[model samples]
Target: MVSLQIVKQSNAGIASLPHGLVVLFIGATSGIGQSALQSFARHAPSPRIYTVARPSTFASHESLLASLRQSNPTATYKLVEADVSLVSEVDKAVNRIIEEETKIDILFMSAGFMALEGRKDTSEGLDPSMSTRYYSRLRAVQLLLPLLNKAPSPRIVSVLAGGLEGPLNEQDLDLRDPNNWSSWNSSVQATTMATLMLEKIARENPRLSIVHWYPGPVDTPGLAKIQKFGMSFPNPMSQEEAGERAVFFTTSDRYAVQEGLLPVPAGLEVAKKSGGGIFLLNPQGESTDNEAVLDEMRRRGVDEVVWNFSQKVFTACNVQARESKDEL
Candidate 1:
């Protein structure tokens, strides 16, 4: 386990890196994403940060950004309004960023939730929970790839169940069938599919460092909601702790494919990558191997299957979005 002390120590070096680093944050309105945003703003040297928030949360997130501005006067923060549970909305958000920025150095995504109340499909015909966790997140990455590739060392940190990927329900990738669509099953499918799709992207963009992190249990509003469901974990990591570690993962070369971020901490070697060439990280910042399941999926061409399915969904979303605009 990479100790919290080491994590903080590495994050402290963020100010030393070149100024005006461009970062995009999806789902930074609350929870782990919010915490990580605050940490990055506090430590980084004049970073130009863009964060996405829904209309309902925009005012509150503006308040958060206001406080961050006071704390880090040099950093620039822009909040784009969009409901990230919809892929079409994600497209709008990404387009807004693309219009202004030439390159993105870091793309930090932690926008997701557990569908404890069961599936609620959006107008786009996808469960909002799964859409937030998987589809929209993937869409943002897909749209931002060109900008990411332009950076000298680009990194993407997705906070989800990285090492705990399980067998996918190949027959029903989206768990559209009610009988197969338990909350747990949806979570598993989202987690597993995210890992597969991200690995494919990592391989195609070798210069990009992608880290899929499972933060175990962190004390946040999300966890509080889970507690009300009569489910809980003991001694969950503090939000501040998780945020610091997340910043470490974002900036430290310990998890980087190329050396552009902070140098790897002493006594720590670069973390190992999965067969598909992305970091599957556990809570403690250690690399995890889930090859038993992942290898078989790759061998069976499941990665390609996922990629093709996702592309179709994205295309459909784009068509629908354009049609809506025309009607408007």
Candidate 2:
């Protein structure tokens, strides 16, 4: 486990790194993503930050951004109004970014929720929980790959279950059947598919650095929403600490394939990437090993299956979107 002191010390160097780093945050309206955004705004040297918020949250999110502007007057903050629960909206959001920015230095995503009640599908005919956690996130990455490759040390940090991968129902990839779908099963499927698909992207784009982190029980508005479900943990990590660690993960060279942003600390060596080139991290920000589950998935070419299925979903979303426009 990387100690909190080390995380903070590493994050402290954000101000020294080159200025005007391009960063985009999805689901930053609240919770871990919001905390990380605040931390970055406080420390980064003139970062060009872009965030997405649904229409319902835009006003409140703007208030939050106003505070961040006060904290760091040099940073440029742009909020794209879009709901990430649909791939079509994600495509629109990334298109706006692509038109404006030449490159993206960091892409931080923590937009998702565990639907305790049941699976709720979006207008695009996708489960909102799955769409937020998997489909939209991957859609954003796919659309932003060109810009990310242009950056010096591009990093993608996804806040979700990383080390915890379990048996995948290869037969039912999306868990479409009611008999196969459950909140726990959906979460596992999302995380497992994410690791596999992300690893594929890493191999294809060797220079890119990807970190899938499982932040065990963070104290945030998101968690508070689910508190009535009778869930409890011994001690939840403070949001501030999680934010600091997130900044370190985004900027530190220890997590990179090539040193470009912050330099590696004196005693630490660059982190070892998983066999597939992605970093599966635990809550403590340490590299986690989950080959037992991943190796089989890869050997069976399940990664490709997941990718192809995801592409089909994206294509369906586009078709539905176009149909809606034509009807209108």
Candidate 3:
């Protein structure tokens, strides 16, 4: 877990991106996304914030927007009503952002939640949770790569587990494992896959600092989503602790100020010093460079295997990364 001091320092500082920076946020309507926006606005000096969410969520989102505007009148908040879980919608949204902006400094994705119901796939043939949590997040990152690359210190913060990776269910990378296919399994699979994939992307595009973080827990409207599926995380303490950890992660200042409210803390700082790789971050806004895990992966030599499988997934999705020309 990231320490309280790191989060406090991050939250307390008045920071701004290198001037002329743009940001794109997915899942901005609730949970970590909204909290990240507020925290980013707390210290950011006039940032252009674009968020994608659904219409029903937009109403509540609007209220949050009002509060943010009230906090920082200079901030520009653009709410894009779109179901980010859909690859097509993500494609359209990325294209829209690219149509206007020359570059995007940060692509922050926090648009995911757990489902209690058995695996549900979207019209895109993606499992519901996986669609929103993993594929959608990756799609946004992939779609916005060029724009992000344009920035001097381009970064992508995807709110999933980065450090807590597991064996690449080579057989069921999609978690179709008939033996166990519940939300618990899905979360683990998604987290592990996301962690490895982020590493792969970092290696492929060293210029882009990719960090996947597990935002301990935040008290958001979306928090109750898991129960709707009629299932639990199976680990009540972890869930409870995650919620508690979320508070510090969002409010902390050390990583927040350094990373600049990109969402979930990042390994940007850590990766910068150690070379490009996924920064497995915890709630208090610190990176976990679990050398053990990295060594193990290196020993197993699954990086290529995981990367190849992910590329197949991304390829099958048929999405192209685009740069944003929009200023806001």
- Supply the global lDDT for candidate 1: 0.92
lDDT of each: 0.92, 0.91, 0.64
Displacement of residue 220 (Cα, Å) in model 1 is 0.7
Q: What is the lDDT of residue 99 in candidate 1?
A: 97
Per-candidate TM vs. native? Answer: 0.98, 0.98, 0.77
How many pairs of residues in model 1 come into backbone collision? 0
lDDT of 2 at 23: 97
Error of 1 at 157 (Å): 0.2
Better of 1 and 2 by lDDT: 1
Can you write out model 2's per-residue Cα lDDT over 177-198, one digit (the tens) per residue?
9899998999999999988989
lDDT of 1 by residue, 176-250 (tens): 899999889999999999999999999899999999999999998988988899997999999889888888999
List where candidate 2 sits over 4 angstroms from the true fold.
none
